[model samples]
Structures are given as C-alpha cells and as structure tokens.
Target: MTTSRPFADIDTWVFDLDNTLYPHHVNLWQQVDVRIGEFVGAFLKISAEEARVIQKDYYRRYGTTMRGMMTEHGVLADDYLAYVHQIDHSPLQPNPAMGAAIARLPGRKLILTNGSTDHADKVLQRLGISAHFEAVFDIIAAELEPKPAPRTYQKFLDLHQVDPTKAAMFEDLARNLVVPHQLGMTTVLVVPDGSKEVVREDWELEGRGAAHVDHVTDDLTGFLQGLSKAS
Candidate 1:
C-alpha cells in the first residue's frame, strides 16, 4: 500500500521502544505517565493538577519530562529514570511472531528510546524479542538527550556506526521520525489500529507525511511479518 519499498536496501533497523514495539491499546505508558506526574508533584511540592500540566508541557517542550526536569530543576537523570519506569510490565504478551520477523531482517537491529535500558530490556524480554537487538541506545546512552533532538540521532549513529542511507527507523510518534528521515533513513510511523486519537498533539498525528515517513502501519507484528516475507 505504501509507495516506497518498505525494507528495500535497509541494512540497519532502528526502533523506538514504548508504544512502537507494543500495541498502544495495552496502555503501558499510562502507568509511567501517572508515575511521572507523581514524581513531578512530589519533587516540586505542587498540586496534582499543576504537576499534570507541567508534565504534558515538558513533554511537548523538551521531548521528555526527565530532560525538562534535569535542565530546569536540576533533577538527577538516574533518579528520574529509576522512579518513572517502576511500573509492572506484565500487561504485554509474548510476541514470537514479531521476534521471528525481526530475526529475519538483515544486518543490525537496535532500540532507540527516550526510556531507560532497564525498561527497554523488560519490554523486549516480555515480547520475546530481546535477543534480536544488537544494542539499545537509551536516553542515558545519549546523555539524557531524547529523540526529535537532532544531536541524539548523530550520537546514535556515531556509537552504532550505522549508515543512515541504508537504515530504517520505526517510531510511534511522527515527529520523532523527522530527524531520521532528514538523515536519509527510511521512516515508518506505527499507529494504533482504528484509533482516531493516535497521539495527543497535532504534530504527532502528522506522521503520515511523505516528506518524513515512507510507510505507515497499525499492526507492528503484521508489518514486520510482511517485511520478513518480502525480504
């Protein structure tokens, strides 16, 4: 259905964690979001309402609340990562089909996330696809810099030695794919199935743009399956 070849000549595959790897219907991020609000409230001694407002604001402004907190409030990155990612990851089911598809892909596969390595590990393990990844370039690995920040992508490439032209990046947020597309990586926007509200912001919803994204899919497992077959 996509005009561009989805996996054509892609030697390296980069993926965002969180909502991209797993279905957003699981609402795993809601747990983390609630915890982030709690952390913000407790740290700032603010009301729940105020904390919620700041949480979304920071997310929009800084690409992540942790980055905002660190820059503005002098919060420690490790402490924030530890506290915010302390939710139960049991809601995600084992997805061997996805694991198999990823396994069939050529060359290297990596996880690039705003989340911590521990959280990424748990999610990948729960999905039974942890072994498929060459490495996870987490927020900490990027020195607390999150995606949508062009510097983080350059760091990821430098550390992994990945060629942008021959790689593909898969992400849930359309905005996150912009820098990757600009860097010549094939960009795929993974959205939720039959969901009108895929993201909270207009910018996130604009991922289907031809300028940045080459493909869009609702079912990540099925998408990977198609890629495996085509490969």
Candidate 2:
C-alpha cells in the first residue's frame, strides 16, 4: 500500500549507514566481525564459535554488543571500538552513483548509526560521500541507546530539531524502522536481495498494529529513482 503522506513534504531524510549504504555481500562488515570474534575469544578465553554465539546473545539482550560487553564483562567501549575497526577498509570503494543520488536528494540529510563517530567518518570517507550529510548521529550521540529503542529515535529527533511527522528514515533493519514509524516518521525498508547478514526479527513483521512503513525497495538506487519521479 502507498502512503497518503506527500513525498514533497518530507524536509529531512535520516539515513542508516553501514549495511544500508552498501550491499552486505561486499563483506566489509565480515572483516569487522572476524575481529570482534577474535577479541571476544582472546578476552574471554572462549573458542571462536562460542565467542560468536555470545556476541549474538549480547546484541539481542543489550541492543549492542559493545553495551553488553561494557555492562556484563566490564569491557571498555573505546578499546573495543579500536580493536574491531582496526582492519583495512580498502575493500570499500567509492560509489559515484550513491554520491550522485545523495546530491540529488532534496532537503536536509543526516546519518544516524549505532557505530562510533570515528568508524562512521572512515566509512563515509571510503564511500567518498562524507560531504553529503549535514551531520552524523553516531553511537556517542545515541549515548549507547542503540536502534530499535524508542528513546534513541526520540534523541535523534531532538538533536536534529526535526519534526518527526516530516522526516523520513531509511534503514536496512526492519526492527530499527519500527520506532521511527511509532514516532510518526515515514519509514522505508531497504531490502537488498541475497543479503544474508540482514537480521530478521519476527516481532518486526508479526506484531499487530505496528508502524506503517511507507515503502520497501531492494536498493537505494530504486528508492531514489522512485522519489525523484514522485518529486
């Protein structure tokens, strides 16, 4: 179903970086995941497989793996971030098409991500699209309040001085899109085909009376094309 909300009225577009900005098959995050598993293994004296399971459990329980480690294992956030993002980002090449799309998008644009500011900066720089966003709301800005949390969505709106009704949130994670919908923002789910790492939470799809997502597209290019036509 299409939304009655006019696309022309959207004054701000909040984008989720990382997986949303690029295809997960690129395996950029897999490198980071390998490092995370290594860290968990070395620090906790567990096998790599065990570490992976623990990381997943922590992410589910604490909204973020870092938060879980910090609270439960007393791991320092800075150290964890430094260790995990230490890999080479040479795999991420600039996407001129993505940059062009961002350039053509109307109104204010900002990046909202659960990653650290340093990581966000590096990723955007690697993509050669750092100039597109006006501001970046990183994990520090979220104050450890990760996505899927209503308070995190509220904090994003408050920090940007945005009217929730007039904003649009584009995220790869269906769960993260829920709170934005609840807060009256137009929600778009970017569902790229064959993205194995895209986590699916049944609650996001099965819950009754949930947030009414405005649109779903396989990639940013299609979404941008549709918006351009609508405009």
lDDT tens digits, residue span 1-231, model 2: 366655677889899987678775566777877888898888899999999988878877777778888888999877888898887788889988888877788889999998888888888999999998999998889887688778888888898899988888988677787788878888887764654554444433333223466777667866776776677
**Tens digit per residue, CA lDDT, model 1, 79-180:** 898899999999999999889888998889999999999999999999999999999999988898898899999999999999999999999998898899
CA lDDT, every model vs. true structure: 0.89, 0.79
Top candidate on lDDT is 1
Distance (Å) between predicted and true CA of 38, model 1?
A: 0.4
Give candidate 2's TM-score.
Answer: 0.89
Off by over 4 Å in 1: 4-6, 195-203
The candidate that wins on TM-score is 1
